[model samples]
Target: MHTLPGARDTRRAARRVQVRIGGVVQGVGFRPFIYGLARQHGLSGYVLNDGDGVLAEIEGASLDGFLAALRAAPPPLARIERVDVRDIPPDGGKGFEIRETIHRPGHTRMATDAPPCPSCLQELFDPAGRFYLYPFISCTQCGPRLTITRALPFDRANTTMSAFSLCPDCRRDYQAPGNRRFHAETIACASCGPRLSASTDQIASALCDGAIVALKGVGGFHLYCDAGNEAAVRRLRVRKNRPAKPFATLVADLAAAGLVAIVDPLSRRMLERPERPIVLLARRTIVAPSVAPGLRQIGVMLPSAPIHHLLFHALAQEARRRGTSAPACLVATSANRAGMPLITDNGAAHAQLAGLADLIVTHDRDIENGLDDSVMTVIDRAPACLRRARGIVPAPIDLAEDGPPVLAVGAYLKATICIIRGREAFLSQHIGDLDSPQAIRRHADAIRRMTAFLGVVPLVVACDLHPDYPSSRYAQESGMPVLPVQHHLAHLAAVAAERIVRGPYLGLALDGHGHGHDGGNWGGELLHVDGSTWHRLGHLAPVPLPGGDRAAREPWRMGVAVLATLGRGDEAGRRFHTVPQAARLAGLVAGGAFPGTSSMGRLFDAAAALLGICVRQSHEAEAAMALEALATAPRGLVNGYRLNGGTLDFLPLLAALSQPGMDARTGADLFHGTVIAGLSALTASHAARLGVRTVLLAGGCLANRLLADGLAGALRNAGLNPIMPRSVPANDGGLSLGQAAWARLCLKDGTRAGIPGYERT
Candidate 1:
């Protein structure tokens, strides 16, 4: 630190400094924040948007101090990526002033969407506020940004909300330099902006009667029902045909939230984080069992939007007036059918949700793009996003190094694409599973719009090695240079990115399915990746998948496939005797009826089917979920399946499948026990073979607590540390980061020998 010469300078001499701030500053009210900071610092200068970030010139008595304050303190929603400053000649004496936005051609940088701001929420409840009760009330600090905007410059005219005209009061607030709403493009009042309408007063009265009303919220309409209403919750479950997947909830405040869910110091802080993501917290016994069903925790969030705030505020006030001890809690799940895009169009909501919803709450501001609320949990004392959406999307992921601009079409399920422009990696919002035509179209549209907005022209395109993936196919058709990334490697790369690891480590990539490098379907794998070079070190034994993809739908086929692969051995042959689907599936497998794949997820489904837990899957992971639900305690001996060099030998495991007298339930229990044993043995073998003591466990299969917990314990007992994603999901949703990391390594020297399994195919 350099100290200025000690001199009595009565007249303050102005000095100017050119500054550049990056990261999530764009579209996040960075310009307004800069303006406020400048005025406060008594600095005279103008701030404007740039291609990669925000740029400003501050001339003041203490330029260095002013720059530091600007970076140290930013609006709640704005995140400073990086701030650079350099001394510049003073621009003469003048008062501090904010300048109009300047458009730089070919500069298309936009920030991600953000949660609703606090001031907007306050005005919603303040009867005299301009936007009292306005569902779409927003300011420079909050409201829709990335999702609703159609183009760059992130102005109202370029957003879906452009349909609504601002009222006089809103215009006044927008033009006021000192107001928080100053230049808030999305600012609007109820009179000339979006309106709130409900089908019946039943809901309106519920809002007034201290009941938690599930209003359709931004990002997507949420299915809101009172949280404490066990019957209402049950009704919601029944109506949505969702039996067990946990639903997110919004509480009146942090105190009220703590009453229903276990809130620790860390969880409490996360609830108050500006992102307003739903935090999965331990459950309180006072809450209804039907809310989460079988799970030990419940997801909770504080009201982020003005409309939500008002509802909770009113509910709390009514509870106070009535002297009731209970506080209102609301279940807020995406308002869409399971495995589909969230409902955003008002007309579509009316047409599709008429039967499911008893009352419908809506607004006039069109949701140009739909996003789901982000879900998170703490892993290793860091906030990890389970489902990154809403406030998180559109914020570019900082790439490790600059590479050829490319588009990485992520895995089929949990489909989200990534665009690499310079050092920024922009992952698209959650696009849902790409099984349906609607989902596929959404994926394409998202790619087009995002690319246009970011103004990045890809020089290369990437896709999963799985040739059958719809996303991969789309990538192939784009007429851009395409690079195929192996599915499991993608998983490893993702873990590496999250850990920011540069060296080789044990990587266990487990998922349902991905096209293997050898043209086989692979799900469970182990690899050692470093700086763009990945080498397969070990993997789970492959199991025959009877009827191929059909077996995934009906898990019983999987059990039969495993039995067939194990050969008609005593335990294996005997275990298939009692299953009804056994005879048919066994016959199919014996006759070489279906394609086979090595997948861990399929194995779980098969185990579930063998246990007679879930014969048919109404949703992806249904059988695996049911299997996890059946686990009572860890009670099994470790067993070893064969490992040929690095590839797992499935022959032994298959010998127990499709036996002469095995019952589904007995087979399931045995399968579960055997898998536990095998995993333990495998971990011990790896520790002995590699002399490495730590392993990273990733992929969608880890979502199965039974598998994750068992595998982790097995690894730990072998004196090895097991790492799992706590901040990022261990699924395809987080695949892009891994893909980007892998690409970074691969593009380094143009070597393709690392993932050698796919070289021939």
Candidate 2:
């Protein structure tokens, strides 16, 4: 190489600039670290904090070196979502400097507070360390963020922790730029920080003995069990009344998880993701079949909380010392019933978890909000949320344009409500099904708390159009101006929110039940959705829903309803002994329930029941799940649906049941094929009518793999694109967002301006 200029010569020509950072940047000491790194690289710059995140500017011979150091070694606990770098005319600065924090709004994006940091973790276990066994050992790097945040510009004064004053030692560390605790937001000692006082050793003893324990964790309470203990798991089931659904498990770490489950690269990344959601992983053969009974995958998550890490670390140590093996896994299920909010109050925990848990390990900190463990799956290395809760939610989804402050009540089951003001949409944690009074109350409280935290007063309310839904009823009771959106339209709105591309796309909404705009039960529907207006272009015929809600519980009723719709005798209905004879007091449903419905879900249920795969459904979507499981192993089944009005005719399939040779399993598969055929036909019709060839599938029924994937594949074969929900759930959890979008459009149109109390009245 030629005698090029030395590296030092290049530095002489470099320029230096000063920058200030804000947002969750303070308690994290991002300034001092930036100063140290700049000095190491012979750079000159200044770093400071305001109310938002950290800000910094650098000048050096190697500009790339400065940028690399900034990104390469970010604080362990400080999660930087965005880094705003702007070029300023350089000053003849000599050296890098770290400066004190300044108060500034809109200067930086505030990051959500993370859990305890590694230094804190080390101190926690060190007997001679200052914070030995301290439950709230936090450095500048970690501890409560949004949970304590009162408002942004995320300074201590704007957080709930503002109530607590700092001690002398802690104050000194916070002021010392060289110390890791410098500018630490929630830094506290054993005497000054949050405390842990146990009432008894009963809970810890129970946990050691492999008993189900209900614990108040960082975000919310969790019902935990040793995954290896079948007896403990069965006990949890009997106590919680959660029988069939697979529970999510918390493994020690990525390595331990890889041992039990087949974690692919994508799934492994999800396990390590900052959100720390339960990753659905395909299981290895080493686990018990009962671990996820009949499931193709198991949900796994890493311990995100410092306390959880400590507990598992101790357990692992004990196992290593004892020279015996113990299950390094624990089921971390929600501490609530199927449709209720998580029990946060200690008294409520004692009452609700007493039966489900042998002992309860709870803390004194009041959980202002009940956030569930976020559940996600990594698809194509992109995060896909199954249940958006802790580490998320209450975290607003930005809008293209702000709306009138509004509270949107989601659909009835798997419900998650959303409250929006400005660019923030504070979505409540998984609020289970909205059928129960307890769930409704929790939904209301979550709404109030989230709205209060965001400092927004909702001027309007949006709700699902299902008039009888408990969520709808609660919206009506609020006495706020209510905007009732059709369930399918809400589904379309949700898709539109994510896509936000263009308007008036054809939306395929396939679900079990939704109140139609024309006052009928609608599930399978095709609609034209623009910015605001939604026109029902085509829908599954309205079928009779005999016994209404009862039909959902017993899918055999759907089969009977379909049979009668096709002119089959009522005598055939008596074959379903699962339904009491009293159900038939209404006689044969001559023209199907509700005249007709193209509901893809009910069609699935009917087919499932007809195939004898699921004659009686004990839980929500039991029939659909069963049908999909059967499809997993095809038993030489062919198509069996009729086409009427260029639509899927479920009646002909029901007529196939009258065939002397067909059995229920065959009947079910035939139904599956039939529904696929109908959906394909429906897609073609909509594409032709709307001149749009793209189909967006939205609904709980779409969660069924057989229908969603099969229909999507079929559509693609017909030269169409089928877009299923990849971000939000296909279920009601997504309905609130959709409802809010539709309401925004309606308010823009002034469609229901004079119709006050329209939903309630």
Candidate 3:
């Protein structure tokens, strides 16, 4: 190997370099790792964290070698995005040391909370260990981060644990350079940490007695009950105002989880991973029916906090005393009213969950940011995040190009905010639907906190085209230049952003509803997206949405409208005889009193209703999911669609569904197959016409495994490459990223072009 003159000079001279390391370097023991690395290389300097990132000044003979090693290997949980090194005059420093964190507002990236590592778990169970029976046991590698952090420069004083000072023994561990707990800000023994009182014991007893217990965890309080207790689960459902939405289960271990749900290798890994998110898996027969209600899949997760483990430990001991297996599972659902923010404070938990929980178990440690457990599921053997929060949030997404500061306020449902600083887009944790006052407040708070922490004032604000959306309203009131992005266009832009494919690509967006540029409701759409501009090439035929939004909640109403659209309005009365409003809805559709929608989601609802799979929806996407579940096998039938000039009609499919002797499952399978065939043909024709090979699939409807997997396979078989979101969600939760990407592209192009509200911005 030949070395350049500059490289040779760098290797030979003793010099000092200022290194700034960015990306997830604040909370995961990065300082300790840096300290160890510097000492190992015989370098003398100090490492400190600031709002921007980790900054270090090292003076050593082998500066180049040190920099190489630092970039190659970091701490187990550290994510190094960029490392900037600059040469400077050598400072006469003797020993490597960890210095106090520098407080710089708006430049630091917050770290996500992590599950307890194996070492910490073992120590938690060891009777002789100093942290035995401690509910808040954590080390440098694990524990709460974003949920407990109030500000940047993540030190103890800036965390919720500041009030609980370290004891003498813990102080020794913190000061010891060689100890793993050295400089671990959250480190504390049972003697000095947040104390666990008799309330936990009472909560455990309540669980054993089939009573709901609201117990505080790392993020927020969770209402828990025995999963096997049907009455208890039902009582909780009635009390919490949740009738049918499935509750997530917290299992003691992998074995316990397997007993309730089918754990494939991939799902098992996700369940045991450090993030410890709730993984939706196929249900077995062990769990009570009421736990998940009408769903065949159950959401299961292992304990993410030491307090949860301690509660399970108490239950296991009691089970051992009785000579039986441990109580392996608990129905752990967020302790909040329907459509409200998660309960974070003890007083709020008690007040809000009064009738729902039989006992309340809490600690003194404050929850700075109330976060719910993240939910994920495997779709086509790939992990898809349903809700991003807790263990999976505050981690920035890297964009292909850096742009000016911008804020993207997400959709009305699954609301989240994205703050773009340079090339990094930091998405806030899930803020949920912006319908309620509390949810809207949470949306505002998240924006304020994220902007204040990141130190970026957005030059441009992006939001949905729907003027009624709370997120859009927030942006309009933000006083910044506002850009209203079409909902489906934003979905396409999000996929492009994640894949870094800036292009004129074919996009298929399928969802329930989005405001179309033509003032119509759009869902199933095909478009040509280039940068910030998109042209609608084709779409599903519009059908009346009987009673408007009411049809979304009642699939039977949509089915009647489908019948009316097919000129078989007489069949609606007999086919939907059980639903009293069927005749009225049919009449309304005939009278043209309802708005028309081209939403693939309403199409799914109609199919489910016509097949009697789901007549009404209790939660979002319930009918669509039930319809997908009924599709047990591929029917290989694809003759039920008509593709005309830029219009794909499914009236033929509705006719087939209304056949007298059609099997419900076969109809569902055929519906899915026909949709796949229709969409693939549509995308292929358009892609060929436009000379594009890549097809992007997005929208909430893509969350359906059958549709996502089937369409991708079909598109590929048709000689077109298909792209979908992997890192971000495909639903409204991911709309913020797309909005931001589109805004950035528009600003880069220097033309208002196709973006809405561009002049206002």
Candidate 4:
């Protein structure tokens, strides 16, 4: 190599280049960040938004520094999916500028709303700041995006904020390229932006008096009450018709969060994420017995909106003046009627929540798209999503390969929709169980809204194989080409798609129930999945399921069924002597045939019932959750299970629990351990037989932290790769994504052999 003596280094020479960026770059401070970086590098160019994403052209001697900063440090919320750079002739342009958005046909991503940034928060509490005490404080760095958006090309004209004109000071900030609020669509001051119906002090006073307040939040309305007030929590529960379900509590900051929950490093990082999700953690103290009755963990979140911060600030101030301790936290939950969607309109919040809340604190700003708080918990020593909403909706999962556009209306419970375009799969916010007309309507609405957001019309629709289910019915009526997929297979495909693996792997799905391809109720299954095709390799041992779906509600029925299978049918009546149905169950014809299942979820119910844990589930998966809660130091028994060919049975473990004087906690540990051991052994056998080293664990049963983490650890020790659900939930909430991906794969193959995906081996 030779050094240039009398010549300038061309590498550092001034040059012009055009850069096209994509991904979650729109409405996430990308333009403002570009403006700052260009100015810092003394470049002359203009950056603007377009249907595709952000585009820029810069020319300066420091082009290298500008390009490095652009790719390395974008806005925190901006997820750069692609970057295309090309040399352009320099035109000797003026100073850099943030240009207007170009409206056209293309694709760009929108991120869900986030909490206020550090700079905005500092100004919010500063007396000298113009936005001090403002509940709608925001900047280019953070604020609502997806929830307030109505159409593409995210801008003030395309948002709900268009209803509120910015004040002079705020307008100036928005127009200034160097200002923090520059191009912040939701930016406004107290004088111009929306206002709370009640003052923060009034809300605080009402809370101190043990009153439930329905407060309009970032995405929708939330029912709020003092978490420390036992009477208030119980009253709210009774009024909301949520008898036993736990309520999430919101705090001011990490210090406040630590007061109520055991905040470990991993948990703290989840809490501090800008998306501001509710994290389930072990309770440090019982704030209120009724808040989460019969539960060892509590769901907690930090302030995601300015109003939430204002209320806590006012409460602390009032407590100081009164010489008393302030309420540590507030019980906050979606302000929707049971089994329905969140309330977005003020009139609806008042009309529907009149009886449940004492005060209705609503605003004039409209909520274009409503979402509830995201929920998470630790699994496999990492955070896993329980419910993806609020700050996490509209996050696309990059697909394995490009395919035709497809829409998938999720399962019957925990309904969510997915719209796939090109290579990205856009999953919608949670719409809840489609058991009511209102819920089904909202589910339909979410589908329409998501398609509009993505600007893509699906060419095909996908649904579960169960014809009678609401989602399946909707797909049949959707008028698009329809592809039906099995429930458990969809679960396995979801994890596969998320991991971006097009492979042959072992899939173990342990769910509550799924409509089998052979027209039977299936749950626990072991299969071999190869791309768009799969084969049923094995499953858990089948047991008689009496009363069909009723067995899922009453764990005692499963207990009776298991006893009958173990040649102990005579014990059902004497064991459950208090129940009148017990005698009838014991007297059923010995040779009577009923629908059978290999469901691990039903097995959990059986264990819970025999251990005298939960007789009738007040909530879905209540018995299983209770058993998991009580489990400690699970230890597998030497002869707990038997594996014969493709069928694995746990009759010996059930028999051990049937013995008199077995403690509930001890039985729980035994059940989890035995199940883990049996599954590990069975999976190893199949993996060895099929020569597959990678394993995918799917289904709702994997949501149990004790079982998922333990089983994953055991599988790793067995020298096999085990993957869990990460981008989406392991429950029915994630089913739509799987359905969408499976449909994409089928469309790619386009063969009669791909139909049904499998033929019984």
TM-score leader = 3
> For every model shown, what is its TM-score relative to the native structure?
0.86, 0.82, 0.95, 0.94
Give me the candidate number with maximum lDDT: 4
The backbone clash count of each candidate, in order, is 24, 27, 5, 0
Find the 10 residues in a row with the least total lDDT in model 2: 1-10
lDDT of 4 at 670: 94
Q: For residues 1-761, what per-residue lDDT tens digits would candidate 2 score against the true structure?
A: 11122334453577554444432354456766787677667777777665446767788775556565566667764545456566678776777675655665442444554555667778888999777766667776667665555555555666656666788888888777678876667677866665544422344345557788888777678888778778888778778887777788888778889877998777778787666788877777555555676666788988777667766765665566556675678878888866567777788888777767777777665555566777876432355576777666544565667666677889788888887665545566777876677877887777776665555666678888777888888888888888788888888777676555455577789888888878777888878776666687777766677677788887877777766665554545455655575236225476332455557678777777666677776577877776666554332224454445545555666667546556655655665677777767776876876688767778877666556667777788888877666667677788898877667666666567433653321
Give the total clashing residue pairs for model 2: 27
How do the candidates rank by TM-score, highest first? Answer: 3, 4, 1, 2
**Angstrom error at residue 209, model 3:** 1.1
The TM-score, computed over Cα atoms with residue i paired to residue i, of candidate 1 is 0.86
Tens digit per residue, CA lDDT, model 3, 423-509: 888878888889899899989999998888888887689999999999999988988778899999999998888888866798999
- Model 1, stretches more than 4 Å misplaced? 1-13, 86-93, 105-109, 116-120, 199-215, 227-231, 234-239, 284-290, 314-327, 378-383, 563-581, 638-677, 691-694, 709-721, 751-761
Give the C-alpha lDDT of model 2: 0.68
Quick one: ranking by lDDT, best first? 4, 3, 1, 2
